[model samples]
Target: MELLEGNESRCQNMFWMNKDVFIRLCDELENIYKVKGSQRISVAEKLGMFLYTLGEGAGNRNVQERFQHFGKTVSRYFSGMLNVVCDMTKEFIKPSDPKFKSIPPEILGDYRYMPHFKDCIGAIDGVHVRATISPSNQVPYIGRKGIPTHNIMAVCNFDMQFTFACAGWEGTAHDTRIFQSAIHNLALKFPKPPNEYPQMKWYLGPYKCQRYHLPEFRRGAQPTGYKEIFNHAHSSIRSVIERTFGV
Candidate 1:
């Protein structure tokens, strides 16, 4: 791809003869492969795997073919690159420490609903991501867009920031189930839950923010749902998550 984009030499010069971060990353990777008796593989070959799979999202055989230009030996180099980048991103891309304090709903920016939904901390929803076909009851795995995929649940905050996401569950799972799983894993993988809500910080007005969780509404022992006045505000703000993901 670098070559396709008119930067092939940059890739070769850095990976081949230069000593830099990629080299260090490759050395660190060799140690990782060593546990599996993969010590004999070259750094370049490991890099090839990473480049082929994640960089281009190519299948294994396609990756093997792509490495032919670099000489098959460099394929392992790609694998090293993929592993290092994956490990790095997982550690880095995370939900920022979200304050319970909420902001005005103007962020929706001329979105159908406005101020009434202001106190919402973030929008939440699920989307489908392509996955390998499965053999069991095939219809459930078939997507409305006519593709084979698993229903990946993901959620974004008011800022369109991907605050939560999960992939691997079968499409059969309900939105509520997917949401619960995402939150549980997010809590364990990250920090403690906040004791307050963001809207608590925003000053009240036609555009102030408010947040409500259905589970909270149910468990709080309220025989009725939220108050009639609150019902409109909550629904308006809650739709943000689905809209953000284009669900």
Candidate 2:
């Protein structure tokens, strides 16, 4: 708590939020989860311990040492906080209206991206997040990068804000397959275009998806003028997803 009040940068690095935001989130968590203080630990300390462990990727033992608590206590609070956060997802993450027409002007005005991508609502991509699973589950979690990971499918709006995320899929699974599963299981939750203009709801994605693809220039052949222009625009527009992931 003293550290959170001390340096702003340190607070951001430790918990990924400013002190005010952290306090607000703590208030929300207490309201929703009814996390009462125990005789040994306060509610604020429990929330801090859990967020520190999550934001810093620190192990339970590390959090125990940092917070001056036993390893079991750190693990208990962290697990409890995780469950509470999961329960609050629907309250925090929500999609825009189906008839929403708030496309970024930067994208709309760009000559390279305007006409072709005017209907695109967002960009969808898969990222590998490292995971540690049991021995029996390790085989399915080995990604193409030869690491144990979860292939997380995400959708980012034009403003680079995450609109949707589907995680916990096996790393060996194809991105398209995970997307299909999301559509099947959570179709109602996904944003849809209005009934009058169904085509307006589209997401830009990699070539593997059933969407537009950039022209491939063969080693020995020159690309046509239209192909060159289209490919350049496609790459430029799709780079937004990469930038979002980098952030």
Candidate 3:
């Protein structure tokens, strides 16, 4: 209550978003998701508790102390909030244009990638998220990072919204394997580019063993040849997925 009623900075600091967004989220949860408030607790308080735990990575005890509630109460609302948010993914995390009818504004408006990457639809990449599994079964989930994690493959348009996501793959699984599995799985309904262009390619990758990373070219090492120039442009355009993952 205090956090939401307080200034914008306090709400942003604790909830990881401003007061208006927080209130709007609470409203959406109640109106659309049918989340209800109990006799003693309001919906905003429940949501604030959930956001505090997530934004701070705080444990149940920390949430209990901060929210002034019992451990069980905090656990119940946190789990409820988590489930509600997951359900919302179906509604929010999708391509703005299901048909891929035209080029995205983010790409169309940018002269650097217009003509060259005209056929490019979006970016695809994989990220490793830490996972908790039994010690006996940890080997399969341990990748080059030497940690148990999940390799999540996701596709996002230039606007930085996830159109598709394939999770639950072990960290050791190769990106190609996960990608192939995702495309082959009809149930996933992965978006496919329209056939307007007969020479539609699945994806474009940088030149092999070449200067690709953005930092490499940023340090006064300008791309010299055609391959290096193409790779540099490709990396610059495809960096949206990297930024999305960073967020």
Ranking by TM-score: 3, 2, 1
Q: Candidate 2 — which pairs collide?
A: none
Score each candidate by Cα lDDT.
0.54, 0.72, 0.87
The lowest-lDDT stretch of 10 consecutive residues in candidate 3 is: 194-203
lDDT of 3 by residue, 35-126 (tens): 99999899999888888987887888999888799999999999998899888887887778877778778878889888888778889999
lDDT of 2 by residue, 1-247 (tens): 6766798988787888888898887787677679788898888888888888767778877887888998878888888878887767656545554465666676888876777777766667889998878788799999788988999887766677776778889889998798777765654365544443433235443333222333444333443466455555666677677778899
All candidates' TM-scores? 0.52, 0.79, 0.82
Candidate 1: which stretches are off by over 4 Å? 1-57, 69-86, 102-118, 134-140, 143-146, 185-193, 196-247
lDDT for model 1, please. Answer: 0.54
lDDT for model 2, on a 0 to 1 scale? Answer: 0.72
lDDT of 1 by residue, 1-247 (tens): 3433345556544344333555565565567534132566445455645644554556656755765534454455555455566565455445665554655345556454455454455555577776665466566777566766678766566665666556667666676676555555645352223563433243122222433554554566542434533644555556666677763
For model 2 the local lDDT of residue 140 reads 90
